[model samples]
Target: MFRALAVAFAVVLIAGATTFLALRPIEQVHSSTPVAAAPLRATTTRPTSPPTTTAPPTTRTTTTTTTTVTANPVSVVENFYAAINERDFATAWALGGRNLGRSYTEFVAGFDGTVRDDLTVTSVTGQTVYVSLIAWQTDGTPRYYSGWYTVSNGEIQHGKLSG
Candidate 1:
């Protein structure tokens, strides 16, 4: 359990650093909206008089830019393990997506057993993730299971476990 927790923390640290480095440059931050160049002056012909100076046309420009912070998908998976290991059911349920929230609520509504386990995350690819865990049941039996968790919009959509 200690090892797993350490690894998880390291992964999160690395990911955070990577994101910071990737978004450090000003060009990268403002790449979405390019600045427009100043317009050229119109040429006029005045044979008898000196050239007339006119101030550039007053242009009012309004730009609307939307900024969205994409939630890290791996955090959800990590939170799931962390919350479950800590026996914080409400936190675990919130980590799940809408569907999982409903499903887990229905499944554990009348249950009273606690799950103490260590979770080993095998892989996380986009919205698909895998984890291997060892859980100790109240009856003193060791339960080993592997789970495949599907995530969408940064939340765990659903998860299936097999022993």
Candidate 2:
């Protein structure tokens, strides 16, 4: 790996080629052994050159995105009727039948003479869902209904559907 240093003053060339800024004078010691060493020099005056300048290091940034989706309120009304059409009473109850202002028995009794519920959603205004319903009877009579249902959190809070 490479190493770096930003020297601001005059650089001194010592024995080795490594770069360094000498803050004080350097002297060589006399020895009796025959060891080889480079000559030494000292400097007492401050450097007259201008200081060097460098730009700051660069940085990187990261970002992430997320998305959310919500179901349509009219679909809830469509599902509620779909459960009834499929004869799944418990599913119908949980979907919003319990909020239709009637007991579970009464809710089931309302469809005693009914054979099928062909549901058609006309329009949706905020939390209110309007629909056109054709409830086919066992006697082959098709009953027509048109009304709006109040829905909140995917559940029918109330309904005014009638023939």
Candidate 3:
């Protein structure tokens, strides 16, 4: 179990480091420009003949609308750690969205079969979507982790966990 935990921690650290390194260059290339909206057109047509009994043709014009998307909840992100610390996999799973909830349950079951009390969340930011944490064993040995949480449509869609 100890070996498995060590390997998991190592993998998380490597993955996080790789993601940070990967995204840094992309961030540098980021650009902000407003896209131009399409123009709208209207047309009027004359009827072929003036008739005693006439029906007008229904004309339809379509317009495109743009909307800003909003994000989801902090407790959704917070609950992952909360559930882990409490060993409440069911609650953690329920806290997440369809896919993430299932993933969290699998992760919990795969990782040590239980979460220790030493897991602590140090800080959370950006809709509580980002978290920094320190998880330790009873002996005070530390495991460091950092991850981002994404929420959509009132549910936690995904998370990227690393150390």
lDDT of 2: 0.77
Tell me the deviation in Å of residue 26 in model 1. 40
Error of 3 at 12 (Å): 75
lDDT of 1 by residue, 100-127 (tens): 5356666454234545777788998778
User: What is the C-alpha local distance difference test score of candidate 1?
Assistant: 0.68
Ranking by TM-score: 2, 1, 3
**If scored against the real structure, what TM-score would every candidate get?**
0.51, 0.58, 0.42
**How does model 3 score by TM-score?**
0.42
**Higher-TM-score candidate among 1 and 3?**
1
lDDT of each: 0.68, 0.77, 0.59
* Model 2 lowest lDDT segment of ten: 1-10
lDDT of 3 by residue, 64-141 (tens): 999976544565666666776777767666666345544654566544623353334445655546666666655656
Which of the two candidates, 1 or 2, achieves a greater TM-score against the reference? 2
1-163 in candidate 2: lDDT tens per residue? 0112223222322312232333334565778877675555544443344345555788988788775544578888888988999999888898789998999999999999999999888998998999999999999999999998888877888888878
